[model samples]
Target: MSANANTTTLWRPTGPVELDLVRALDRRAWPPRLPDQPIFYPVLNEDYAIRIARDWNVKHSGAGFVTRFEVDTAFLARYPVRQVGGETILELWVPAQELDEFNAHIVGRIEVVHEFR
Candidate 1:
């Protein structure tokens, strides 16, 4: 894969995150691996991103946020894209230690698409 593959492919985080965490990720364009979280999830579509951030995340915590960004498709290829319920919703499960490398694969700034509180 090309070194710049991250520039062309898009990624979005899946799951509800705190407002502060969302803002922090936007500032850095990548997220640090949380302790014991084991997997870093990035979804394949806006619909899923919205669903998780709005429905699941907010329902669980009273706050949720979505961020869109680009990642190296090549690096992403190393991990499997999983389907939790059906084909419409898909996500990549990145290992924790590898999350840093995954962060490196990020191409640009992460922007918030939706926020709920």
Candidate 2:
């Protein structure tokens, strides 16, 4: 589906367990973060998502997936884009306690765009 002007696309690099939880949610929402996970970070670019999925998730979980989704641009404006590395390595850090609200802003189903094992 085409994203409207009010929407912004985001990508997430996830491990198999997280992917399964997403699937369980029927792709409509992300599950609550684990106790140790304080933030839910969705990346700003597909390439960076791919790198993390392949390099980190795969190494740690034996499988990795890149999921793409769109969220309301206005709602996302509250979180500043955080650049953890290079210019392209950008993401929005949504507080774990706010994930349900974040999920409410998602524009469409989260889709698995790439996978590595």
Candidate 3:
């Protein structure tokens, strides 16, 4: 879906297992985090997502994917942007408990924009 002022685009780098769970949800929402995962981090740029998918997820899981989606800008305001590394390495750290609410703010289906194996 096309993004407008009310929505912000976000990208997620996911492994095969997580990608399958997203598919099982009809591409509309992310699955609940595993017990050890307390945060759901969606990166702010495609390049960062691509870096993680290609360099991290692929090596760890044998495959990786970058998915893009839009979320309500207002809803996203609750979380501050986090810079984990270089200036372009930005992310939104949504608490795992809030994922269902976050999912409700998604504007459209999550689309897989890149993949590596």
Candidate 4:
């Protein structure tokens, strides 16, 4: 929706989401949560940028969504530092109507799942 430069919060890390989960990922993979095209975003390790696809996982999962699909050496290359750390934030490009349902599933992993819903 806007430039990736903004450090605004999508969803803040609070409680379990805030404490351990945000900083415990060795690797994370998400499905297409953005657009199909490429975009530039800053990383914690680099100053310039990296090219990322909005819907990068359409073929594998068959859904326009991001998942914790796997973790291998190759998988390490899929994310920018911004999206790294714990619970590597991902998306499942869906319609606005499905947000509530999807949010419910994710809540299962967090302490505030019920409050978030």
Candidate 5:
């Protein structure tokens, strides 16, 4: 396939999310950041996702999940990539109240790609 900068991208949760929130994402509804979470983070690769699910989320909450969704690549192109300890993570500087607009930019369905318990 040709490289398209505006194509759909795979994103994984930055941390273990509650099943309730997971369900919301599955319906293409991106939830607002929690009280202490100032930013909404989603990584660009599956490896990073797996590492988080296995190494962090599982340890914290005993469960983790991955979500596959499409955002307007053009919209995402405006943001800078944040490298956290060798991991290229995408940061959406979305405030809690703007989650609806965030979800509006997403194309198609948000799927649960993997789950760890």
Candidate 6:
């Protein structure tokens, strides 16, 4: 996940797994900084994605029901500035199982909202 250049310590995990995870999230990074908080949007974005994923993971971690997600495409095309110069304010989330695969192909299904029963 990312934070404001000012308030965020810019802390990120290091490793093949972590690197891919960050890159995937980079695709949806928000460009505008909230007037007050450093992580106002990015954190919220990541949290939303993660919360959904965590739930899916716990419910289906062993069953392989986890899926990928990305920002609403219409939201991006309507306001291209949301992605300012390709800078992302969105954070991506995935099960550790798919982390390695993402390193090679960042452009693919990001998260599955849910798996079918």
What TM-score does each of the candidates earn? 0.78, 0.97, 0.97, 0.18, 0.78, 0.22
lDDT against the true structure, each candidate: 0.68, 0.96, 0.96, 0.26, 0.66, 0.32
Q: What is the lDDT of residue 14 in candidate 2?
A: 99
Error of 2 at 6 (Å): 1.2
**Candidate 5 Cα errors over 4 Å, as ranges:** 1-5, 14-17, 87-98
Q: Of the pair 1 and 2, which is ahead by TM-score?
A: 2
lDDT leaderboard ranking: 3, 2, 1, 5, 6, 4
Clashing pairs in 2: none
TM-score of 4: 0.18
Give candidate 3's whole-model lDDT: 0.96
lDDT of 4 at 49: 12
Name the regions of candidate 6 deviating beyond 4 angstroms: 1-44, 63-75, 79-117
TM-score of 6: 0.22
lDDT of 5 by residue, 1-117 (tens): 113456557666534455567575566766776788676766677777777877777778888777677787776665567767674554445556666676788877777778877
Query: What does candidate 4's lDDT look like per residue over 1-117, in tens digits?
Result: 212222211222122222232235322211222354243222222111111111332232322211121122232244434544334444223343443333333321221111211
Better of 3 and 4 by lDDT: 3
What TM-score does candidate 3 get on C-alpha atoms?
A: 0.97
- Rate residue 89 of model 1 by lDDT: 80
Candidate 4: residue 102 Cα off by (Å): 0.6
lDDT of 2 by residue, 6-115 (tens): 89999999999999999999999999999999999999999999999999999999999999999999999999999999989999999999999999999889999999
Between candidates 1 and 2, the one scoring higher on lDDT is: 2
